[model samples]
Target: MLSQKDEWVVEELVPIREKVYQYLKNEILKGELKTGERLVERELADKLKISRTPIREALLRLESQGFVTTVPRKGVIVSQISLEQVLEVFSILSSLEVLAVQLATERLDEFMTKELDELIEETNRLLAGNEDEEISQFHIRINNFLYKAAKSPRLYEMLSDLVDYIRAFAHIGYEVPGRMREALHEHKDILQAMSERQIDKAMKMTQDHIENSRKAYIRTIDSVKKK
Candidate 1:
């Protein structure tokens, strides 16, 4: 059962299904809900203090996104996606984000460049101070900048869906050695190019940035396999 604070955070008045899904998704990503663990719908409903209908809806949605699976007589379990599947999702993400950054580059203006400069500076500060907890949040901030500048709804939706499929195991890249330094440098370089209106350079750098993350995750997988 979730604690009182967590329960409060999970339940919302509108769009209850998305809240439920996000709650469970966070659980899986943070390893609170382990891989292959059964998702007993009734227990989740009782724990969340909600009716089973929304829980069912969330589970079905997660299943379609490849986050969970329904088994015969075994109930629902977090899907243990293979390494190949992980790479495939990352490949899709790289392509989608490449397109996003390209569009964002084309639309870059002085105002947006200033906004990006501030972001990169703050990101650098966090990295220098070793603000580990803010790593994911920092990445989100950068991605949001590109996402907004890109101004493509359908592309964003597709990228988000592909991300959800592999998010449960996303810690792999973060756990890799020297990932923070590498990723931070990548962000700085990519943004510098974008701010200078070097669209082609920015596009290639963004592709390399995402591809580096994919490679880091693969290394993490290989290490785990050896153990």
Candidate 2:
């Protein structure tokens, strides 16, 4: 019931759109897409060896995920990562992550506790080696494990979207000196609190960690803007 051109378009674009989305997401997370840079659909399509439709679709998805924004009658552009926005995000995320850790601590068994301790040890090693990428991965792994242990589908879904936004700004905070070391120490404290079954202490430690990270991100962004 469709025209040949329309069928061809659909066949060609579906996979291309998915691939483009993945590529853009990674680029944004890696800070390769500079803030305020214009995103040209035609150029991107050509670069990716695809048509405009897929590029547009991918851009729209990125916009929804807060990686980019579109202006009426204009075009898409990378969203600027501001210190204020970072603080706001951290405020909300800190609460959610604390809740997740609290729930996880209550529900996790001995096996999960041992797994968390192992992850902490690995994260400490990565931090000691100054392996920023591995440290980031360990943070993600810890959060994912806690989310899974929490066993709350609704909370996981909410935090997943938040995590996407957090990742977009991760490179900024990751580059800050001493931030990784502080994060490692805070993560250890949270793990210790959890291990001791001190739910309130774990929650507070998680909140404090996020607050400190937010402050560091704000300071870094302010310095960057000044330069």
Flag regions of model 2 displaced more than 4 Å. 1-16, 225-227
Give me the overall lDDT of model 2. 0.79
For every model shown, the clashing-pair count is 0, 0
User: Highest TM-score, which number?
Assistant: 1
Off by over 4 Å in 1: 1-13, 109-111
Clashing pairs in 1: none
lDDT of 2 by residue, 38-82 (tens): 899988766666688878988999888788988777678889766
Worst 10 residues of 2 by lDDT: 1-10
TM-score for each predicted model, relative to the true structure: 0.89, 0.82
lDDT of 1 by residue, 107-209 (tens): 8777887898898788778778877668767876787788777878888777767765555766578788779667878888888888888889988998998
**Residue 114 Cα positional deviation in candidate 2, in Å, after optimal superposition:** 4.0
